[model samples]
Target: MQEITDETELRELIGEPLPRAWEKERTSLHELDRAWLAASPFCLLATAGADGSCDVSPKGDPAGYTLVLDEGTIAIPERPGNRRVDSLRNILTNPHVGSIHLIPGRGDTLRINGRARLVRDAPFFDDMVVKGHRPVLAIVVEVEQVFHHCSKAFLRSQLWQPETWAPQAVPPRAVLAQTLERPDATLSDLEDYYGPSYADGLYRGQ
Candidate 1:
C-alpha cells in the first residue's frame, strides 16, 4: 500500500472539480427560502464535540416548528424524543452545528451552518407552542451560511415515490416498554397515555 504525502500526489489522486450545475447556481436565502423552512416538518441536525466527535440526529414536528427568525438566524423547538440529547451535548461542548431541513415530496433542502445556543426562556417557548404543546428547551442558531441542497439524493433514492414506500408496521410501543422493563404495560395503555398527552408534554415550554 502506498501513501501520498505530497500535495501534487493528493491532487492527482482526487483530480479537479467536476462540472456541476449547482456550482454555478448557488443562491442565498430569501423570503421564499424562509417560507420553505417554515413549511418543513423535519430536519437533520449535525453537531461536533470539542474532541471532534460528531453526531447527526433527526428532529420533526407537524410543520413550522423551525422558525426563521431572520436571514441570519433560526430557531428549532426541541420536541420529545429518545432523551439521549447527543446533539445538544455536542453543541454545549462545541458551538458549531449544521442542519438540513427537508419537506416530504420536495426536492429542495435547506442546509445551514451555524453556531447554536440552548434557550430556556418562557417567552421563547411560548412563541413555539403549537396545538397546545411547548418545547422545554429550544435551540437558537445564528446562521453563518445557508444554501439549498439539490435533489440528487432524493431522486436517486426515490424517496417520494409512492411505489417505493414501505408499510408502517413498526413494533407496538408496549413491546418496547416491556423490553425496557415496563413488564405490565399494554399497547392500549401506552397509546392512551401518549396520544392524549404527548402533544402537551412535548410543547410544554412553547
Candidate 2:
C-alpha cells in the first residue's frame, strides 16, 4: 500500500469545498429560530476535551424539546440515560460545541457552533419539564454561528427512504450481551423496558 503523508496529497485527495458548501454568510438566531427548533425532533451534539478527544452524542425528544431562549442562546434538556455523561463531561472541560438539528424526511438541517455550559437552575428545569418529568440538568449554548446545512449526507445514505432500509436482525442484542458477559441482561427484557420508558415523553410531549 502506498502511504500519503504530505499536505499536497491530502488536499489533492479531498479537493476544495464547493462554493455553496463553503458558508460565506452568518445568521443570528431570532424569534423565528424557534420555528426550526420546534420542527426538529433530533440533533447531534459534538464536543471535545482540552486534550482534543472528541465525543458525539445523539439527542432527541418530541418536536420543540429544545427551546430558543433568545437570539444569542438556546437550551437543551438532559434526559434519562446511561450514566456515562461523555458529552457533558467534555463540555465542562471544553466549552466549544457544535450541534446539528435534523428532522426526519427533511432535506435541510440547522447547524450551530458555539460554547456551552451546564445549568441546573430550577426555572430552567421547570421550563423543560413535561408530564411531571423534569431534567436534572440542561445545556445552555451561546450561539456564535448558525446556518442551514445541505442534505447530501441524508441523500447519500437514503436515510428517509423506506426502500433502502435494512432488516433489524443483524448482530442480535442477545449476542452483544453475551459477548460482553452481561449476566443481568436479556434482549427481550431490554426491549420491553425500552418501549414504555421511551414512550414516556411521547405520551406527554416531553
Candidate 3:
C-alpha cells in the first residue's frame, strides 16, 4: 500500500479540479438550488466534534422536509431515531456541518456547507409538524457554500436501478443487542421489546 500523507503528494496524484466545478458553487442558494432541495427526500448530515472526531448521519423525510428559511439558511427537523444524539452533541462543540442532499433517480447531488445550531423555537417546531407531531428540536444551518456534485459515481454504480440492489443482510436486532454488555438483558427480551415497537411504525412521527 502507498502511504502518501502530505498535500503536495496528494495534489500531484489528483491533479487540478475541473474548471467547471468552480462554476457550480455558490455562497447562497438560488432558484434552481431551491428547486433541487425541494425535490430531495434525503440527505447525509456531517459533523465533527471539537476533539476532531467526526460523524455522518442520515436524514430523510417527505420531499421538502428540510425547510429553506432563506437564501442563506435552512432548517432540518430532527426526527427521532436511536436517541444517541451524536450529531447534535458534535454540533455543540463544533458548529461547522456539511450536508449532501439527494433526490431519487437524480444523478447530481446538492452539497451545502454551513454553520449549524440546535434550536427549540416553538413556532419553528410547529412549522415542521407532520401528522400532528412536531419535532422537539431542529438544526438550523447558516449556509456558507453550496454546490452541485457531478454524477459519475452514481451513474457508474447504477444506484437508482432496482436490478443493481441487494436485500439487506445484517444480524437481527436482538442478536446484536446480545453482544452489548447488558447483564440484565437477553436476546429474547430484546426482540420482545424492539420487534413490536418497530412493526407498529415507531418511526412514523419523528
Candidate 4:
C-alpha cells in the first residue's frame, strides 16, 4: 500500500470542499449559535499538550451551563471530578482548543476552535453556580473559528435513537471501576460509590 504523505496527493484524492463549506465558518457567534449554546447541555473539550499529545474531556451540566461572555468569547465552568485536570493542564502549554457542543437527540453540533486560558475566578462565577456550588475555575475561550457542523455522523450512527441503544451491552460502571480502576475495592463498595447517591455530590466538593 502506498502511504499518502503530502497534502497534494490527499487533495487530489478527496477533492476540494464546496464553496459554502469554506464560507460557513464564522470568527464569532451568531444569534443561532447563541441559541445552540443555550440549549446544549454537553460538549467535548479537545486540547493538545506541548509535546503534541492530545486529549478530549467531556464537560456537561444543565442546559445553558456555558456562559457566552460576548460574540467572541465564552466561559465554561470547571466541575469537580477525578481532578486529573488533564485538559486544563494542556491549555497551559498549548492554548489552542476545539469544542463541539451537542444537544440531546440532535444530530447536528456547534463547533468552536479557539485559544483558551484558565481563570481562577471571575465575576461571572456567580452566574454559573449550580446546587449552591460555584465553580472555582473556568476555561475562557477566545473565539477563533465557529461553525455549525453537519449531522451526517450522528445520522449514520443513530446516536439519538433510543431503540438503537443497548446500554447493558457493556459492563456496568461499578463493575468496570472495580475490575479496571480499583482492584482492591470490592464490587459492592464500587456499586455504592457509583449508585444514585453519586450524583448528590456533583456540585458540592472541596
Tens-place lDDT per residue, model 2, 7-100, is 8998899997778666643557955467889988889999999899999999987889888887888899888776689999999899999999
Model 1: worst 10 consecutive residues (lDDT sum): 20-29
**Root-mean-square deviation (CA) per prediction:** 4.3, 3.4, 2.6, 1.2
Candidates 2 and 3 compared: the better one by TM-score is: 3
TM-score of 3: 0.87
- Candidate number with greatest lDDT: 4
Report the lDDT tens digits of candidate 3 across residue range 112-155.
99999999885767677776667888999999999998899899
Compared to the true structure, candidate 1 yields what TM-score?
0.74
Off by over 4 Å in 2: 1-9, 18-20, 23-27, 30-32, 172-175, 181-206
> What TM-score would candidate 4 get against the native?
0.97
If the candidates were sorted by their lDDT against the true structure, best first, what order would they fall in? 4, 3, 2, 1
Winner on TM-score between 1 and 3 is 3
User: Tens-digit lDDT track for model 1 on 58-140?
Assistant: 98887888887767778898876777899999989999998999999997788888899998764667778777767778999
Query: Which numbered prediction scores highest in TM-score against the true structure?
Result: 4
lDDT of each: 0.81, 0.82, 0.88, 0.95
Q: TM-score for every candidate vs. truth?
A: 0.74, 0.83, 0.87, 0.97
Query: Candidate 4 residues 100-174, lDDT tens each?
Result: 999998899999999999999989999999888889899999999999988999999999999999999999999
Q: Residue 9 lDDT in model 1?
A: 94
